[model samples]
Target: MALARQLFNRRMMWMLLGCLVVFGGIFGFKFFGRYMMNQFMDNMSLPPATVTTAPVEQQRWQTRLSAVGSMRAINGVNVTTQAQGEVKAIYFESGQFVDKGALLAELSALPETAQIEVLEAERRLAERDFKRISALYKKGVATLRELDQAQATQDQVLANLAVQRATISERSITAPFSGQLGIRQVDLGQNVAPGDPVVSLQQLHPIYVDFSLSEQDFSRVKEGQGVELTAAAIPGQNFSGRITAIDPSIDPANRTFLLQATLQNPERKLRPGMFADVAVKVEKFRSVLVVPRTAISFAPYGNAVFIVRPAKSALAESTNNKAVAPSAQAPQWIAVKRFVKTGEERGDLIEIIEGVREGEQVATSGLLKLRNEGGVIINNTSPLPENLNPTPDNS
Candidate 1:
């Protein structure tokens, strides 16, 4: 009976072990199959990305140098007082346009007026005595010395009266040039001393923009070159100007030269003290090689572009250079590492000064996924990824 019971326990243990193995296999197969199917479905449903491109063309490339600069007025004058006195009245309002010699401010002139009257009375008394003396001299009744004293006294009094009139004129402030007035710092009855600024005036019809160029650039720049400017206040609006002045001497410490441009402020919209972005057209290259900035893949070694050529030729070039493949699905591309010397960049277009020839298409789009000798599909769309509209005429 003991033998039979032991055998029965062993049989039950075997049955339990078989059931556990069957259940484990079923769960493992279901989980593994589901994970693999999900990955396969994801790969199948992905869509190809759309791309844009630009055909290589020959054109005259305008070399432009861009820099940050500030706007100034053609003639900005700070109106100040020459004599110290109490402000009697304000003649002009802030932001009011005035002509040359227009009265802008007036100081106290009551004391000056009284002094002029006193000098006039003294001159009258002196003149009466001088006339009487002159009559006596003509008749030989008065000596020459007495007549001379009276004449000198009368002349002195006349000079004093003239001096008083000139002093009164100085108390009134007048515009030195035709311009719009800035803020008035003082009101009536405010005391101002000599050299105190009364109001700021600026002639803005033809504004001036001041900028600095490096000594190397200054050597290449010339007067009458076309310049462009844009202010922060006026978005999307450009102002055109010409290089009016260039400094003869280069600053030795900074190796920069000062320059000025004259811009037309028609409508008087531009004001002084505004920050401006300036661009000067230095050179106009004719029928030059140009490329989109997106085409140039910059690396520590050099800058390169992908040329869409026949698959066999691209493979031969890549095999010859031994380049790594890119891990993305862009058009089949071949990396052509050319040492190109670049010129000025304007908008999204850059002038290829050297190492590129006309009529050769460079990759403007799909640059990030390009590999050496990879097959490339040409998509000729546009060269500029940004705005391609011609710049507005701000002349």
Candidate 2:
């Protein structure tokens, strides 16, 4: 009888465990479904997000090519001495403007000058002797050989004097052309060797600016085309110039076309080795739909934009009042994603080729909170940037 009671007690414990497991499973399944349905309904009843919008308008677009370049002097060189000698005197000061053929410095050539004087005295004496010999020979008192010897001595003395003068000229260094001089490198009374640099001369007027463009634009770029340049050193000042030269052969390594432009720098504000920014007008478009560059969103798939979807006639105008406090004066708009065919970007603005029209409005600032057909309200109190050619402010 005790054995039978033990089997019955085990069966009762097993039945109670099975009942608890089944009841918990049923309750948990119902709770999960109810919670998930609540979340779905909440997302469906979400209010429209506020976003800033701008109208796409037609504007005249002038295509331009931009490049970074460097400034160079029209004529620049380092002045050097031809002959090695001790500096005797410096005729010009450092950083002085000199003319062509003006003496810059003189080397000690005293010995050569003294030798010139001695040759000149000998030449005079030989001339007098030759005259006497010729007179004597004409009267048959002197031999032909004696007269010939006298003439040769006079010619030899004159040639020696000329050679001495040329030696002195080599010792004296002069400016080759008129230009502003740099600081002198050699000191007074210092011995300098041949080919040693003395000063640097640079012609500041009409400087040249060299820049490069892609080989694809080789046909559009030509000599005499106008270009504008600006330098960071001199702010707010723009220099205008024309294309002086274009390299016929493209750079095979970089596939670029090297170009040079000439600009008049009368004040000498533009200097050699300065960094310059260059712009050349390529072509113009009569009418184009443009928007702020910030309005477009770039993605791996393609470039896209959020266009304001029109109101539906079937939906009530007061529908926005259901989710959030809505104003009757404010127009309701829905965001619709569109892939656009874009053209060149002009500074802060960009050109839209297709997928949008002139009268359509686009979301500019609030792109983070948007979906394919998300509802939104248009608020343009803070407008997007409209600068077509924006530049950084250095100051």
Candidate 3:
């Protein structure tokens, strides 16, 4: 019985030992799998990102003040009639160019023309009687009063004729100035009253552009300052002119002052009331650092840019150590994010006031995928546009 009991104990002990080995193997396998995964992840590296880059450039930039404006003719008016009468004849066609004093229309004047003939006949009769009275007065056969009466009648008749001629002249309508005419408002035989619109006349050549500027810019502007203009109606065309006039008083509501610029419209393409974009060259040219606008990464906190440089060089600079020795492999490039201070923008380029030096390469595309100190492969085959004055591409 003692031997059997001892054998049972040993069997139980062996079973327990087998159970411990199986559980230990399972736990160790799990821990080994987890350790292998962490090692693989730590050694792995992301693929280099493809990006486009542009070099920082220093150039002379003109300082300009911009504003919206409207085009106007130097002389524009709504032509109207001065006399009340029926239009007997319409001499001018719609949109015809005319000179000063050129007849535009004529009113019906038959009554006034007929009255002149009667006055002339009456004057002839008065002159004959005055001659007979004068002959009698010289022979002492007529009273002085008789001679005076004859002379008075002749003078009265002459005055009546002069009044009739003046009345006939008012029936004619003529151009007040040399300009192009708009659509005709009066038709033939249409009765028109005084102050009624006849047509519109505008002197389009050497047109004026009316714009306003802030009162703060008042001192920077003066008569004869150069201005450049562009209109959406006529795209891709630039018009140059000079400031011709400036309002002495500032607008109380907006605190802006009015300015008028004169530009020659030889093609007559610029019409009155056209909306225009005006840029006044306010200051002399000065040197400034510029970069492609796409290079900037705008954020609510601040603006930033990714500067591309040799990976070894960047790492060494960050560590404040000397550059690593050159390797046999090709040089690796990396993107380093940098905060920047920006100024006014022109076209697709923006002025960089701080953070980057001239000639340093900056990433212009693929900014979203880039990380600080990340590897980059430059592919400028499809470079972004960097025009100083960009325009729409309808094609």
Candidate 4:
């Protein structure tokens, strides 16, 4: 009985030791988790270790709108044949630069020429007979009725000659305007019918840029306004133009108006059908405040920007009564939420129409870590990260 009691006691002691070990482990894990959470809070609550800033400078701000459109030629035409006949001669080659009234091609004019010659000879004979009859009638050798009949016959022949000459001219094809010609649709000796397209011609020196704007923008857009255009075909190069025409009436379906601009394509580099990025400056405000796009937080209610004030020092010398604290309560380290009315955006900078005033420094780089009344450190000496430029990868 004594041995059994000793064994039972030993087992009870081992069970007690196991429970204590388990309890200690649970307590340790709970304490460690709390300690880690506190450390994380301390780090996050701390102001951002570093930041970059830009001075809010006063400069002229332009309110402009941009749109995408396609380029077109100012004057373009498709040359067609007016007379149906066998192509006798092609005066201009395919893709030739032709002058106004220059002969582009000709139909078989032999038959028309022969008819003109016959009519001319008959007209001459008719005139001679009419003159002789008039003289005879004056001398009383011919009757008045005979002189009248001769005069009528001469007039009829002259009219016939004129009609035949016009027919001859119609057989020859001439360029109506000076332009560059496209590929020839017909070859020499090929029979062409009336209304058949001979070639295409376009004057591309002064090209046309056509873009549409909403009715809200139409009133602001005026004739003679300058436009800047860039094409994807020739990247980095901008073509300048001026608004030459605007539709007075708005399209009910789209609430937009068509705008036509004429650009001087001196190099003939801009081609029709190329895509363009068009910008029109509608208003210019002088000495306005401007901010980076990254600084602005666009929300449904309104746009907001966070301004950063300097943090206070805590050193004995720095803790003077006049010195401010480095906390949120400190006037020196403050986060101001300003609602800004934004205008046109160019690159990464946006034009501020109202709200935020000039010379206020805003938090730009570390927006993800910012709050309404969070503390911020202005490290203006450091450059803003290149990735901070507002974009989804333009390059």
Candidate 5:
């Protein structure tokens, strides 16, 4: 019995020691996990993000009505032949500038020239006969009927001569107006018919641009309103002109009115059929709150901007800690995302209608790394552009 009691006591003591070790291990693991979590939380505090910012401004913005337009020459037409004949000579080269009534081409006028010569000879003989008859009639040698007959014969010959000359003129093609000619459509020895296109001519100086605006804007627009034009074909250049004409009636099919503007093209750089963007200065300037377009974070749900301000949490911590001087430590700023109402957009700036005030600085760059209440540092060494009218670099 003594031996058994001793053995039982030994077994109980071993079991008790094993249970204490298991419980101690479980509690120790739980404490260690808690400690690790605290360390991770401390490490998760992120540093401030560097960003560029700009202050919201109040600017005088002019109202403008915009539309797409097409350019046209003041005078454009296709020069054609007036009579049918074989082309004998081409006087002008392709793409040449010619004056009005300048000869372009000449058809084979050999037959017509021969006929004119014959008619002239007949006219000369008839004139001499008429003179002789008139002289005799005055002297009473020739009768009145003979003088009248001779006079009639001379008039007939003169009429025939004029008709032959007109036929020759019809065979010669000339420029109807002063302009530049396009590619020549005919060559030497090529037969052409009447009304067939010979070449295209266009008076390029003082070009016209035709555009349309909504009928609602008809009352707001008038002749002499200033217009600014930019074309995709000619970038970085703007042409200015004034409205020259407006359609009297609106198109019933589209409810739009046509507007025409005249621009001087002394260089002839603006060509017909080129597409252009037109902006008509419609109203006087008005003051409005504006911001750089880059500052806004556009979203389908709502548009927002990050307004920078002092971080309250950091300020409180600094206040509590007397050892850390406010001046010694770098200033802390936080980006607070605020929804905004935007109005019309100009070149690089946008009108802010609501949710922001003038003189408040908003983050312009590094927006993708930003979040609400996130830490930020303002670094405006390289700021984004905010021009009202931005131009492309020639390079």
Candidate 6:
């Protein structure tokens, strides 16, 4: 009985020891996790971290709206023939410059010319007969009906001559305006019908830019306003013009208004159908705060920015009591996350409409690692893109 009791006590003691070991392991793991978390928090609260920052600026900001547009000719048309005939002579060369009334091509009008000669002869004979009949009727030598018949015959012949002359003129092709002509579509002796295009004539001295503005911007747009344009086809070249027209009605489908501007393409660099980027200056704002786009932090709650206020030590020493803090001097830069409301954006810059004032510094780079009320050292090693208007990549 004593030996059995000893064996039972030993088994119980072994099970108790196993439970203690498990409990000790749990407590050690919990203590280690707490230590790791404390270390992480200490690192995050370091005195200063490097970041790029720029000062808030106040300037006369020019509000501009951008849109895509297309270039068109002031006067563009395809020169076509109005009558069907065999092409006789092509007087113009391919891609030639022509003036108004200049002959381009002529169809075979030989048959019409021949008929005109015959008509002329008949007209002369009828006129003579009419005059003779009129004289005879006045002397009572001819009947009044004969005089009327002769006069009617003379008028009929005159009408035939006019019709023949008009038919010949229809076979001739002429430019309707002064412009550079496109490639000729017809050759010598090539039969062409009515509505056959001979060539394309385009007046390119002054070109028109057709674009549309959103209905939200309708009230700000007006005729005679300045517009700047750039073409992706022609890089590094900018064209300037004044708004020549603004549509009186809004487009119900897209809720936009069509506008047109006239630009002088004197060098013939601008071509029809070229895509253009257009910017129209709406108005100017004075003493408005502006900041680089990099400084903005977009979030679901609201847009915020990391502003660099003076460290606790600097604030304590500052003469202005408004910047003072109750804590002791900590001699390091502080990053204060401030929620801001921004307005229009142009290129890489944005207008700060609210929640930020001029002369304050905002972190421009290294913002992804920032925390609210964190410490940041100002480092401006790299510069941000600063363009008032930027060209967009079509790709």
Task: Kindly list the per-residue Cα lDDT of model 5 for residues 1-395, writing each as its tens digit.
Answer: 99999999999999999999999999999999999998776545566799999999999878889999999999999999888899999999898999999999899988889988898899999999999999999999999999999999999999998888888898888998898999999998998999989899999989999999999999999999999999999876788999999989999999999999999888888999999999999877888999999999999999999988887753453423423223334548978888999998878999999989899889999999997666799999889998877888768
Candidate 5, residue 161: how far the Cα is off, in Å? 3.1
The candidate that wins on lDDT is: 3
Residue-level lDDT of model 3, residues 1-395, one tens digit each, is 99999999999999999999999999999999999998766544657799999999998988899999999998899888777889999889999999988898889988888888898889999999999999999999999999999999999999988877777777788888888999999999899998998889999999999999999999999999999998999986788999999999999999999999999998899999999999999777888999999999999999999999998677766643433333344438988889999998877899999999999999999999997777799999989998877887989
Candidate 6 residue pairs in clash (backbone atoms < 3 Å):
none
Off by over 4 Å in 4: 1-58, 284-343, 347-395
How far residue 252's Cα lies from its native spot in candidate 1, in Å, is: 1.2
lDDT of 2: 0.84
Q: For each candidate, what is the lDDT?
A: 0.78, 0.84, 0.90, 0.77, 0.89, 0.86
lDDT of 1 by residue, 210-317 (tens): 898887787678999999988878876778999999889989998888999999987898888899989898776566666787877778876776666544455665
Give residue 22's error in model 6 in angstroms: 5.8
**Candidate 1 ranges beyond 4 A from true positions:** 1-45, 283-288, 291-343, 352-395
Considering lDDT, where higher is better, how would the candidates rank from best to worst?
A: 3, 5, 6, 2, 1, 4
- What TM-score would each prediction reach against the true structure? 0.71, 0.67, 0.72, 0.65, 0.79, 0.67
Candidate 1: 10-residue stretch with minimal lDDT: 42-51
Q: Which residue pairs in model 2 clash with each other?
A: none
Q: What is the C-alpha RMSD of each candidate to the true structure, in Å?
A: 6.6, 5.9, 7.9, 7.6, 7.4, 6.4
Model 4 error, position 151 (Å): 2.5
TM-score of 3: 0.72
Best by TM-score: 5
Alpha-carbon deviation at 239 in model 3, angstroms = 1.2
Compared with the true structure, the alpha-carbon lDDT of candidate 1 equals 0.78
